[model samples]
Target: MRKLFATAFSLWAATAAQAENCQIIGNQTLCDDGVSGQRIGNTTYWNDGSSSQQVGRFTYNSDGTSSQQIGNHTYYSDGTSSQTIGTTTYFSDGRSCRRIGNQISCD
Candidate 1:
């Protein structure tokens, strides 16, 4: 159907636009949309840089274990979200998570 085709094209175009901003710098691909991912030395890292502080990292180590953090702007499947303005994550259950500045509160 024409409507289905248009909807699919719109989704694909949006995704392509989001992916096109990254630039290959050395081993890193840096994007204007607050994400940078690269292999730095022996470690692989992805970071969020929505603000000057750029507050999170997912890193892979040579030993096979990995470490990660969520910050800057994070969104949950429940439509809760976080960013420099702080964040809220809601669960399908009654529980919720919230962060304001450096403080985190959950229920």
Candidate 2:
């Protein structure tokens, strides 16, 4: 009887630990302590643990596309983003580029 009780307690403890480790919502996993950040669909949400500070949010689209947002800046999956200079076009394979005249070339 004592051995059975010990085994049951151990099993319960292990199950509780696993439950507290991580949580899955939709296609994302959210850590309880916020150390792993929150995932939504194909995107992940991260914060600096500051209410007034800006954080990065990434979203991956189904059509081989993704996006990143930080503060007022928005980045696309093609490695491009909206900058103060102008609209930047990035290659599909993660290469940086800038629009020169009317064409997009690597920067």
- Candidate 1 residues 1-107, lDDT tens each? 11111111110001121122334456554445545555444333555321111113433223333322355433332243333332544333334444344333344
| lDDT for model 2 | 0.31
- lDDT of each structure? 0.31, 0.31
Q: What is the lDDT for 62 in model 1?
A: 30
The segments of candidate 1 whose C-alpha lies over 4 angstroms from its true place after superposition are 1-19, 41-43, 49-107
Residue 52 of model 2 has an lDDT of 14
Residue ranges of candidate 2 with Cα displaced over 4 Å: 1-56, 83-107
For candidate 1, report its TM-score. Answer: 0.25
lDDT of 1 at 35: 50
Determine the backbone clash count of candidate 2. 0
